[model samples]
Target: MNALAAQALISARRALHQRGELAVRVAFYAIILVIFSALWSAAAGANGGSISGYDAHSLLWYVAAAEGSVIATKPRMIESIGWDISSGAIVTEMLRPASVVGLRLAAELGEALVRLVCSLAVGGVIVWLYVGQPPSAAGIALFVPASFLAVGCNLAAQHAFAGAAFWLRDARSTWFLYQKLVFLLGGMLLPLEFLPTALADVARALPFASMAYVPARLASGHVEPWLLLVQAAWLAGLLACAGGVFWAGERRLEVVGG
Candidate 1:
């Protein structure tokens, strides 16, 4: 690899590992899992021990899988992109021989990998203890590729959203709306299975499902091998689309004020 790529990788790794962020992030995931488990337990007791084919244990496990998958990835690439723009660092970035987009992409991937390792190590143990046995060996094996696809799709989506910063200058509203949609459509709060048929159909067709739902479903043994292939295809397609958007945004770039 070239020096710029190497430097970007190093920077990404440093950013992820700095100030014990990995530990803090893992703790956050664990705390969320605890809260989710308690809520599920309370709901199960009130509802006579089942809600939508999942008891407290299964629900907790599902939440754990979802949380782990989410915490494992870097979802704040847009915010970073925005900060880079606002700070005028982007001007210097654009002057580099390397592709700014490519550098950011590599950095984000490195950061995501670091986060994924920390989450799986800490969060996996918590899930096993409270939720149940960890996903089976086969399920764990499947999660490797499933997670790669999921994170790729998620980063692509996030970068595409961040690219809007180039045009909007202040994209807080857009980012908030996009995040809320992800929470709902990505099945982070509830599995798509529980949604109305029409909504669930839409969710499945969108890229959001590949982020949390597909991997979580695979972790829970709810998906078929064929479905895994479909998720991979979605990841590829989303990445391509994100790349196109980033390129177009770069071409249209106008740096305001310094």
Candidate 2:
């Protein structure tokens, strides 16, 4: 546990020092938020000034919240994990921790938490200036837990997907497909409500919605206690899936005399 914590801190500091790259990513994050907010605002204007329980102001805020957590991630999490496995780095990492997966997760978490804070700060400022006011105090309070779970669930799923590298020797294609799934089913660009009725239902049933939509929706002031429960359940399930995949991968390596 202490080792994991130290790894997280070291990763965080390393990420913090890469000011140029982090600045560019945060700028890109800000730009995407602005573009989406504008598009939603125009749509609302063309309609009756609101659509599907979302007005221009609230819609902007929603996009900010949704994308904030969604964008606060390692861009090549799955692909990098795959590369580590294929290059035999995972084997070396296994010597440092009882499980390579736990160490990698700890490192990623440290880096991601910093990025999450920066992304959320940019998002909050954008929405506040454009929309005039943020969500209610209670909604703001709940957003932290909801968004934390959102990030956790996403990372867990990515780790599970990365296990494909153990067998396939490549995770790029898998990463591509998984990203699209998150972009659609996870509602990274838009809320689940924007999806078709059937599609929305499926998204809700899956873990994807727990990644972005739940926290975003809650931050928009339509807090539902049940959605948090849904996020918790999915987090548990995805963590299990990740653990299972890595456990099997380790066994595979051992059997192969790696």
Candidate 3:
């Protein structure tokens, strides 16, 4: 555990050294939020300034929070792990003291957490300009844990998907499919409440909601603490699944001489 934490910190520090890259990423994140916020405002104005209980102001805040919590703007874990496995790099990582997947996850989380904070800071200011206020203090405070849970669930899912590389030699296609799921089912663009009732119910029952919607809702001032419980449940299950898949992949690689 200490080793994993140390690796995470090291990776985060390394990521910070890429200042120019980080600047571009943060700028792009801001641009996306601004554009989407404007579109939402226009749509809301055309529809009496509120849709599904979200006014233009509220929608902008929601978009800000949601996009901030996401927008990593780095290599997705699926591609990274896929590359490692395909290039025979996993062989060296397998010899490390920590579990391969755990180590990779820690490093990814470290960098992602740093990026998330930076993106959210910029995004928060943009939304504040739009709405004339920041998210509620309670909302901002609870968003911390909610965002962590969201990242946990997301990374676990990606790890599980990457395990397919043990056989397919590339998981990038899976990553693409997962991105769409996050954009829609994960509620990156809008709240799941806007979806049809039956579809919303199904989406909630799935693991995607725990990835983005749960944190975004919390950040947008929906202080339902129980939402974190659901996120936690999904995180636990996804983590287990990721572990199982990666372990199986490791076995396959070992037997097949990757």
Best by TM-score: 2
Each model's C-alpha lDDT? Answer: 0.72, 0.84, 0.82
Q: Candidate 1's residue-wise lDDT over 1-258, tens digit each?
A: 885468657866786658477777888888897888788789877999987776776676667766777766655557777767655577787778887777776677777767776777776687778756744556656766777777777777787777767666665545566666667798877878789989999998888888887777667655455657877888778777767876766666653343
How accurate locally is residue 12 in candidate 2, as Cα lDDT from 0 to 100?
89
The TM-score between candidate 3 and the true structure equals 0.95
Q: Estimate each model's TM-score.
A: 0.87, 0.96, 0.95
Candidate 2, which segments miss by more than 4 Å at Cα? none
Worst 10 residues of 1 by lDDT: 249-258
Candidate number with the higher TM-score (2 or 3): 2
RMSD of each: 2.7, 1.3, 1.5
Give the poorly placed runs of model 3, Cα more than 4 Å off.
Answer: 73-75
| Cα lDDT of model 2 by residue, 124-178, tens digit | 9888888877656677778889998988888889999899888877887677788
In model 2, the Cα lDDT at residue 212 comes to 83
Best by the lDDT measure? 2
Superposed by TM-score, candidate 2 places the C-alpha of residue 226 at a distance from the truth, in angstroms, of: 2.3
By TM-score rank, best first, the candidates go: 2, 3, 1
What lDDT does candidate 1 reach at residue 38? 87
